[model samples]
Target chain A: MLGDEAEAEDVLQETFLSAFKSIDSFEGRASLSTWLHRIATNAALMRLRKRQPLSFSVDEVTEPGNGNLIPKVFYDWCCLPESELMTQEVRDEMRAAVENLPDTLRVVFLMRDVEGFSTQETADILDLSLSAVKSRLMRARMALRERLSAYFGGAASADMEGTRYE
Target chain B: MSEKHAHRDCSHLLAGLSAYIDGEAEAALCAEIEQHLAACENCRVVVDTLRRTVLLYREEQPAPLPEGGEAAPVQSVRTG
Candidate 1:
């Protein structure tokens, strides 16, 4: 999410204003909400670009070329019950993990996964090619999974306790 | 399964797992991924957790709307 409240407000206002002006262009291809979201996402991306113009590189995370498919860390949580996976602490960790993603990956992941947009919708919204969206999304999910695994894998509770005592 | 065959490298499969999980992959690719998953524990765990991550996130409420600004009604946007 764009961190600055003032800037986010500006983008929100601009989104609706622009949406109003271009209401005629609403072809009914996407739902009204998706269209609005696309506009808002573009507005936010523009603000992000202005603040850090040089940081918007699609190729920052290298594609996994032909190699072993082994994960950096693997903990089998398939045996864990769904109730355990859905704990508030885990949810908080997941939110934090998503927030920590790089902007490019974060936006794509949020649009596709969090907002329930199709991959194509996300690509269109962010003006990214489909492959780029796919790659960024994969990387984002992988990063979050690795981070969350630390929590579910039992390393996080000790860290949490240390923070509490300190 | 033989060690060589059992530890089948799945880089290609891993690359497509996101699309596969999202139901975006072509049927053939989905079949391939399923076949690989049937034999590979590592890929299975990665895919499973990645899926749960998405589900957990979807369950979260959308970020609070900008403070003090309710969503403009659809009627207003249509008229203005």
Candidate 2:
């Protein structure tokens, strides 16, 4: 969403308007949410692309601001005393970290981790291969691990110490 | 830790980690993985990390959907 509420409103209006017009063309091949998500993602990306100039390689253009898109969170999970473990504050931070994932990664993570959906079900929702779903889920975890490294003491290092979850 | 678990690393168990955490891993493999985790610091850390993450995931309740725009226009809509 744009920093402005009004702008976000406008973008959403345009997206739904376009969706309504082509609603009849949608087949039973995909879930309604999946189809709409595709349209909405396109609309949102198009709006952002217009405002930001992209570099073109051949006919494909890469958006300018994409490279500098920082996540909303930058907190470390470690350094806290064990006394504060599983506090609401920590849970909220973890939720925010999950939300900070990119759209594709977030969707995959939600479907697999949050919803307890099978990899195949998630693949269907995202129109991706099972391997692709697994790959994205792993990437999502890695990103989260980086964000949460302070608390977990870096899984890579912890792993070296034989720190399994049990 | 059991001998089978003590001999395995996280990389070897990554594919089955989620299932194992979900308590869906087979009894034999689970015992082996558990043993390995107790002996191998790296795998133990991986388990701890994933266990904590899964706990966080379980506590996540979706926030209220935005009221405006097409933000979540059709969550209840069934097209099939």
Candidate 3:
């Protein structure tokens, strides 16, 4: 999501304006909601592209060197109670982790996961291949998983009890 | 198995994991991933945590757009 409220407002306005202008071209191939989402996504991408260039090289943190996606450090948090995992602090961490992702990965993850767009729809919206969207999504998830692990696996663990591993 | 084959297998399964968790993977691939996950504790942990992370985000309420923000009426576009 656009971090600035003002910028988000601008994008929303621009999206409506653009969609309005191009309504004649609305071929009914995609649903109205899908079309509007595509416009919104493109508007966001335009703003993001202006702020930073797309990252073509994958980050080294989750790069599959030996064909293994193994985390440098892994902790099992599967047994943590939902009450603990759903804490406000954890929610904030999730938001921050997502916001920290590179623009390319973040956009795809948002369109695919957050917006509930199908993989094919996301790919078409972002003008990326299906495989590319999948790869970026994987990288984004991996980075977030590692970050959340570091958070919960460290000091946070002290505050919560009954964190068991299988 | 040779090191190369073992690494390839791991890579293959790892690459397909996101799709598997999303219920997008083919049945054959899902079966293979499930089989691998049954035996590989590390992968099981990764998949488990990754799934939870996505779920957490999904459960969040979407931030509301600015107040009184109305879409441009489609009728205007059609009429124009």
Candidate 4:
């Protein structure tokens, strides 16, 4: 649900109207939720495009009074909790990292990783090829691993201390 | 095991292991993976880490569901 009350109402109304309008083409292949999310995403994207926000690239950073600028750290992989093997902080970091993913990657990751949708379901929902879905997921995971390695140390070493990695 | 033998070259199945753990892998591949895991310590570690990661990934039982209480405009929540 959109947090803004007015926005939520408008979304609800528009969604119903669209559904009614397209009732003839309603195929039962996808779940209602997936269809709704697709509609919502489209609506939301349009709104964001119209009301542009100030752009801030991750690379650019500013320092306070001293004038010595500090570079922003872009490594975000460690934020994802690897497997029930990490501490809460690590898990939270993982969530943040996932959240920070670009819009496309974020959607793909969420549909597959978070929502428990199969690769087929995800590809169908996103209108991406199966290979594209797999590749994107792999890339997203690799990016997370790379970032984790940067922040926490070697990818293989960071998670394995007392424990072992095969 | 020799250094060459110490690392069980299990990265090939690291991803598969996740599926295997979830009982989603093909039966033959599952058996093969388990066989590999049984003999190789290095590969075993990889499996252990990956398994642990998967557990962490799905840590919550019955994860929180969105109530849709915040009702907002459809056209406003940007996807792109």
Candidate 5:
């Protein structure tokens, strides 16, 4: 999420140190990984806030379908073959698409969709409400869909043999 | 249908789409969205690509785990 390799490593080291110092606070209610994940997320967010505080604020969560995220690119790229979609170039594009998301949406999308966390888990990790998680996730997915559409929109057709998204 | 209920509008249906794909949506809302998708080609493409986008990202390689070390203890990720 920080989008810098050195900074990401710094956050990782910081996460372990924090966990060590606060070991007594480990309630063990959630998995160790989840707890660590939360620490890591907060650490990353802290760095993000330090860099561009105004852009990282989650004070005003946007409502779903509020017109800010209206789908502009309606091309259906899901018909592309798996080999075509999973190419290194496409993967790089995928990573860039995610990296380009706003901080709030990017964090929610990573925890919920990328990490397989339940929406509630994501809310708890981010200190957001369940509804907030849902709305943010909805916006994040739509934004990514638009980005990917630019790449795969006209590359193939639904009639292509061995369609995987069917 | 009431004039106040423009729920069929593409933007309105966009709100419930993630829930619909995630199976977190109520059945009635799901029906409403699917109904809209059948008639709106753009919405159909949006929903399909949205679902696919989520799926694609879900398969992303996991982030690296923190390696354990007993080096000088410092600070945790969060702060006051």
Candidate 6:
């Protein structure tokens, strides 16, 4: 989740050092891995706060039950050849698309998808409700899907999307 | 894509899409989504591409190195 290579390197040391300093405080309520991840997440958040205004809070005001995040891209872009799918250019775009997500959704996406945390684990770690984690993850996926569609299907998706509604 | 189901509410189904994709949705939900997919071309495409999107990210993850601290030795193929 930090997204910067140098920052990640620096944060790794910081997280370990912080964890080392706080080792005695460990209550063992959560798994050792989860505890370490919590520390690392805090370190990342501190770095983010120093870099720029933080975009989200842990208790971000919830949106509507069905927030306006409907899938807008209708084209089937999955048929792209495997060779084209993971090409360097495509990979870069994928990474960029992830970076573009709002911090709230991006963090959840990373914790769940990239960090390999279960949805319940992510919610427990972040102190978010289960539903919040689920909704944020879905929004993140849908947003990335739309961004990626622009590349695989390009303008054709817009045309395909035209007939979506009644 | 049919006119008969054109105005049907697809929003509620959206909430369940991720659960459906993750194989965590209830059997009733799975059945509902499948039945919806049969008639909804747009939803079918969304589900397929959404699944592809998740797979692409998971696939992009680098493979873990071998368990040893250092390089694992490969046996020499050439006979002396």
On TM-score, the candidate that comes out on top is: 5
Q: Higher-DockQ candidate among 1 and 2?
A: 1
Question: Superposing all C-alpha atoms, what RMSD in Å does each candidate have to the true structure?
Answer: 5.1, 10.1, 5.6, 11.3, 6.5, 8.7
The most accurate candidate by lDDT is 5
What's the alpha carbon RMSD for model 3?
5.6
* Lowest-sum lDDT 10-residue window in model 5 chain A: A153-162
Kindly indicate the candidate among 4 and 6 with the higher lDDT: 6
Fraction of native contacts (fnat) of each candidate: 0.58, 0.11, 0.49, 0.04, 0.72, 0.55
Residue-level lDDT tens digits of model 2 in A77-156:
33346556566766766776776776556667776787676787677655578767765666566566546654444534
TM-score winner, 5 or 6: 5
lDDT of 3 by residue, A1-166 (tens): 6677778777777777788789999999988988988898889877877876645344533464522244543567867898888888888888899889877788888877788998889888777788889888887887888788888888556655445541
Q: In terms of DockQ, which candidate is strongest?
A: 1
Which candidate would rank higher by DockQ, 1 or 4? Answer: 1
Residue B70's C-alpha lDDT in candidate 2?
Answer: 46
- Model 2 reaches an interface RMSD of 8.5
Q: Which of candidates 2 and 3 is the stronger one according to TM-score? A: 3
Judged by lDDT relative to the true structure, which candidate is superior, 2 or 5? 5
Error of 1 at A48 (Å): 0.9
Ordered by lDDT, highest first, the candidates read 5, 6, 1, 3, 2, 4
Candidate 5's displacement at residue B36, Å, is 1.0
- Model 6 ranges with Cα > 4 A deviation: A49-54, A57-61, A65-68, A155-166, B2-8, B62-80
Give the TM-score comparing model 3 with the true structure, all chains together.
0.80
lDDT of each: 0.76, 0.58, 0.76, 0.53, 0.79, 0.78
Using TM-score as the yardstick, the better of models 1 and 2 is 1
Please state the error at residue A135 of candidate 6 in Å: 1.2
